[model samples]
Target: MDFWILAIRIIFLVQNTTGIPGNFSLLFYYLIVYQKECILKPTDLILMHQMAANTLIILSAGVPQTMAVWGLKQFLNHLECELILSIQRFGRSMSICTTCLLSIFQAMTISSRKFCWKDHIVKAVKYIGCYISLIWVLYILINFIFCVYALIKMDNKNVTRDFGYCSIIENDKIIEILYAALVMCPEFFFSVLIAWSSGFMIVILYRHKQRVQHTMSTHGSSRNSPEFRATQNILALMSTFLAFYTLSSISRGCIALLYNHSWWLMIVNQFISLSFPSFGPFVLMNHYSNISGHILVWIRNKIHFILF
Candidate 1:
C-alpha cells in the first residue's frame, strides 16, 4: 500500500516538475520570442525567476521526499541524499524569496495610488531594495542555521525530532505567531488587495461588457476579447494564490491549535505545505489563455514530430 502511494507521489512529482517548466518553456517561447510586442518586462523576469526557482525547489525538495517514502534507504544515506538535503534547503530559502516576491509584486500592484512606495516599485527596474533586503535578512537569519543542521543530520531517521522548521512551532508559540504574522498577515492583506484590485477591474470590465452589450445590443462586448481575457487570467492567478494560501494557512493554523507532534498529523501538515508550490504552476497556466495556447501548441507539435 505504501509502495503504491509512493508510486503515485513519484508520478505526481514528475508531472509537476515536467508540467511547470513545460508551462514556462511555452511561455518563454511565445512571450519572449514569438510575440513581437512582448518586451521582456520586469514582471516577465520575475516570473522567469519564479519558474526557475520552482524547478530548483522540486529538484531538491520534492524528489528526495519521493525517494524516502519509496523506502530507498541506500539512496537516502548516499551522497544523493546529502545533495538533496542541501538543495532542499536552498529551495526552501528560495521559496521564501519567491513568496516575498509574489507578495511584494501584488502589494505594489495594489498599493494605494498615493502611496510613496508605488513609484519605487514601478521604477524598481534594478531591485526593490528595502523589501528584498528585509526578506533576505529575515530568511537567512532564521533558515540558514537550521538549514545547515538539516543538511548535516538529514539521513538520520531522527531528523524529525532533531530539527524543527524555522523553530516556529516547537520552541515558542509567540514566535509561531510572529512568523505566521510575517507570512499570513501579508498573505491576508494581499488577499484583500488582490480581491480589491480584481473587483475594481471587474467593475471596469462589467461596465465595458454592459456598454458593448447596449451598443451592439447582442452578444457581449469585446470585453471578453483577448486583452480582457488576459486581465481575467491575471485575476485567476491571484485567486489561485489566495485559495491555496488560505487553505494551507487554515491547516497551519490548525496545527498551531493542536500541534502535539502526532506523526500522522505532522505527515499531513508536511503534505499541506506542498500545495502552494506544487499546485501553483497549474493554477497559473490553467487560467491564462496566452500561456495555455503555447503549451497546447508545443505539445501538439512534439506529438506530431515524434509520430511522423
Candidate 2:
C-alpha cells in the first residue's frame, strides 16, 4: 500500500467513525433530552432532519467507500448496490434541501417584525413538517433513476463505468443527459437558494450589529442578542455546507470528465463528499449551547460516579 493511500484510508475511517456517533448524539439530544424540557421548535425539527440525513450519508456512502478502499471489492450484490446508492443519493439530496430550508427559515426568523411576509413565515413554520414531507416525496421521485441504473460491478470487459464496489449500467446518450439534468438541476436550484438566503442573513446581521453598536454607546453596555448569535451560527453552517459541497462537486466532476475509473480520484472524491457530513454536526451543536452544556455535565457526573 502506498503512503498516501494509507493516510487517506485512515482519514476516511476516522471521519466515518466520528461522524456517525456525532450525528446520533445530536439526534438523541434533540429527540430524547431536549424535548423532555421544551417543545421542539421548527428549527429544531429541521436540524434533527439534517442530522438524520447526514447520518444516512455517512452510513450509505462513507462507510461503503471506506470498505472499498480497504480492499473490499464486489462485496455488494446488484440489489444491495442499487439500494445503497439510492439511499446515498436520497441522503445527499435531503442534506441539500434541508440546509436550503434551514437557511430560508433562519432568514425569515430574523427578518424585521414589519416585514411583508411576517404572517407567511409564521404559517410556514406551523406547517414545516408538511414541507419536509413534500421534499422527501419529490426527491424520491427525482432519484428513482438511481434505483434503475445502479448495478453490481462486473468484469472489466463488461463494465462501462465503475464506482469501486458498484457500477452504473450504461445507457443511451439521451438517458445519460436526462439523468444528469435531473440530479444536477435540483442540487443547483438549492445551492442558489442557499446563497441567496445567506446573503440576506448577512445583510440582516449587519444592520442589527450597527443598531446594537449605536444603542450600546448610549447605554454603556454591549451584548449579542440571541437572534444575532443564532443567525451567525446559521451563516457559518451555510458557508461550511457551500464550501464542502462546491469542493466535492468539483472533485466529482474532475473524476467524471478527466479520469474515468481512476481509483485514487474516486477515493479523493469520497473523502471530499464526506467532509460536510462529518463536520457539520459540530457546527450545528454550537448553536445549541444548552445541549453541549448538559452533555458535559452528564459526562462529568458519570466520571464522578465511576471514580467514587
Candidate 3:
C-alpha cells in the first residue's frame, strides 16, 4: 500500500521476469544448441554452470523476497525456509566460485601460448568437468550443514527470528561470528582470485594492443581472435560481479551488524543481490553475437507470423 513497497514490488517483478527467462535461454543454448555448430569449450561449460546457479538464485531467493515484500506473511514454514535458504546459499556460493574459475580460465587461455606450461593448462581444461563436479559437491555439503542447523535451531522457541515470509534461528555471538567467517572468508578469497585474474587479463590486452598498433596488417586478425574476445568478456563479467557483489555484501553486513531492518535498506539489499542474475545473461549475450542474432531472428519470425 505504501509507495516504497509498491516500487520494490515492481522492481522485483521486473527482475524476476527478465532474469529467469534470460538465464534459461542462455542455459538452453549452451547445453543443447551449442555443440551442434562448434566444439564446446571449457569456458562454455563454466558459463553454463554459472547460468544454472544464477537461475537457482533467482528462483529460490528472488521470488521469495519478492513475495515477502508484497505483504506475504509466514508463507513458508520452517522446513521450507531451511530448504529454500539453503538452495539460495548454494546457488550464491557456486555463482561466486564459477565466476572466479572463469576469470582464471580465461587468463590461462590467453597466456598459455606464451608460457611453457601450455600442456598443463590443456590438461586442466580436459578435467574441467571434474573440477565443476567437485565444486558442486563441496557446496552441497556445506549448505546441507546450514540446513540442518537451521532445522534444529527452529525447534527452539526462544531463538527464532522472523522475516515476513520466512524465519531463521538467532544464534549466540560465537556461532554468529563463526557463520559469518565461514561465508565471508571463502568469498573474500575468491574475490582476490578474480581481481588477480582480471589484472592479468588487462595486462595481456594492453600488451596486445601495443603490438597491434605497431603492426597494422595483423591488427584485425589479432583483435578478432577468440582468446582476445573471451578475455575481454570475462573482464567485463568480473567487473559486473564485483560491483554488485560488493554492494550486496556491504548492505547485508550492515543489516546483520546494526540490526537495522529498515524497509529501504532491505529493499536495496534485495535489489543489489538480484542485480547480477538479472543482467548478467545480457552481458554474455552481447559477447556472443550468434546468441543475439538467434534471439533477433526468433523475434522477427514471430512478428512476421502474427502479421500474416
lDDT leader: 3
Worst 10 residues of 3 by lDDT: 217-226
On the 0 to 100 scale, the lDDT of residue 296 in model 1 is: 64
Tens-digit per-residue lDDT, 175-230, candidate 3 = 56666677779988998999899998899999997887777765545444777987
- Between which residue pairs do clashes occur in model 3? none
How much is 177 displaced in model 2, in angstroms?
3.4
List per-prediction Cα lDDT, in the order shown.
Answer: 0.54, 0.83, 0.84
Distance from true location, Cα of 255 in model 1, Å: 3.1
**1 or 2, which is superior by lDDT?**
2
lDDT, model 1, position 46? 53
* TM-scores vs. true structure, each candidate: 0.60, 0.88, 0.89
Model 3 spans with C-alpha error above 4 angstroms = 34-39, 173-178, 217-223, 294-308
Candidate 1, residue 90: how far the Cα is off, in Å: 7.9
Query: Which candidate, 2 or 3, would have the higher lDDT against the true structure?
Result: 3
lDDT of 1 at 276: 52
Q: Is candidate 1 or candidate 3 better by TM-score?
A: 3
- Residues 90-135, candidate 2: write the lDDT tens digits: 9998999999999999988888564887888879888999999999
